[model samples]
Target: MSQDSLDDAYANATYIPGAAEYPPRWTKEARAFRDNLRENDQIIEDFPYGEGAREVFDLMMPETPAMGLAVFVHGGYWLRFDKSVWSHLAAGLLARGWAVAMPSYDLCPSVRIRDITRQITLAVTEAAAHVAGPILLAGHSAGGHLVARMACENVLPTNIANRLKHVMPISPLSDLRPLMQTAMNDDFNMDEAAAMAESPIFKKPLSVPVTVWVGEDERPAFLDQAMWLAEAWECGHVVEQGKHHFDVIDGLTDPDSLLTQMLIGGDIA
Candidate 1:
């Protein structure tokens, strides 16, 4: 595809079709997923946070001491979804001898995107305090964007940022400029200044390790976002596999997959 076509696809892939048509059903499925995951795991429900918003994180540990901590952030384009839906992800990391922490932040429109970012930062920082060893940050979609931001902040001497081992941004939205063209902007509220400020691609390279992952079948925009962030950071790897946006995350569940190996600090071919 041409460069322009690729750009258009990334900007529009996050746009949900018929979003106004199924609020009830959507809520039912989301809740079901959350409840199902919670039933199987020992999760720390409703971890407190700023204002009225709070985050819930599920911690999964291996039988022995953990090799490290993997803090995961869920993505609903920064609007929907929560940590509960992603608790199943902990099983894979747990088997690999790594502790996993999944945290949910307040969705957009209720809270601005900036505040949402801050809330996630607080959630990860708090979780890091209780877990042993350094952290490997990972997230899907908007969650990927948040992880990238946290990795960039590792340049600072803050306790949380300093403890970061690496970052894996799966199908991340690195550049917010194109998102302004979509209806998602309604909740994202990406003013030109905020877009530039929040975008990881526009920021300086992070000293920490970063690995970008996108499915081969994902929209061009999604792939570009991964590449853009990888280039901007000037210190990461990118993997394009034969999966789509959602299925790409499923690949991480497989211990032998490249996604899992990268998370565990193994060689990625």
Candidate 2:
């Protein structure tokens, strides 16, 4: 489909209602996950990004110099949640002797989406300097948007973009035009121009590897976004998880899961 036609279809698309309340049950599970992080894990909270802006990121390091680092960005549709909620994701990477970094960016409406993307760039660039080895990027939801943006060489410093061995955007929001038509945009404050600018599918593909994964049970829009990114980048792999949006991330914590094997570079069946 033409970009314009896609935009038009997205503009007219119906907005699917998300969970009405914060998934309290998931939040509780996340808390337990956080408590279980290795004792040696280090959290560098509220690191400065730009003037008057800070991002929180936690680091989980193994006993030896890591073979590679995995940086994870948390998802909340660019408007809600924080890094504390995703420390659980670090546990599995740490066990594999991969250092992990989870960064929290300022949410939208209060801060424009572009600025939020910039903040993530800053966080990752800074985190990269401190780690000992190559870096791999991963994120869930809005975080997937940010990390995908980093794959674009022009969007990030040349050094940082080139340093990425791979990028895994889980349950990503690859196209933002659909969001402009939804109530979610009320806080996102995105117009046509902003949507096009932030949409990864509209950007030129990076040479770096990008793997896009989405839950089989997710909304069609979500699944389409993943497919769009995979085709646009032409360097991404799409994995279908027999799970829903929220539960799909749980795969990150299970080393035996396909998601983990892909992230850590295990043989894919």
Best by TM-score: 2
Q: Best candidate, lDDT-wise?
A: 2
| Model 1 TM-score (2 dp) | 0.83
- Lowest-sum lDDT 10-residue window in model 1: 12-21
**What shift in Å separates residue 257 of candidate 2 from its native position after superposition?**
2.0
lDDT by residue (1-269, candidate 1, tens digit) is 45455445754334445434444453455466446556766345665544554565656666678888898888878878776566656656777778777787888788777777777787787777778788898898999998888877543337767777878998898998887766667777778999888888987655677888777877877878888887777766566656777657765566666678887787755
Report the C-alpha lDDT of model 2 over 1-269, residue by residue, as the tens digit.
45454444433113323544335655666577555554445444455555554465666666667877789998888878887777666766776778888777788788889988888888888788878677888898888888898887688787777778889998888888877766667788889999999999888867877899887877666788888898888865665756666767877776566787788776765
What TM-score does candidate 2 get on C-alpha atoms?
0.86
Error of 1 at 172 (Å): 0.6
Q: Poorest 10 consecutive residues of model 2 by lDDT?
A: 8-17
Candidate 1, number of clashes: 1
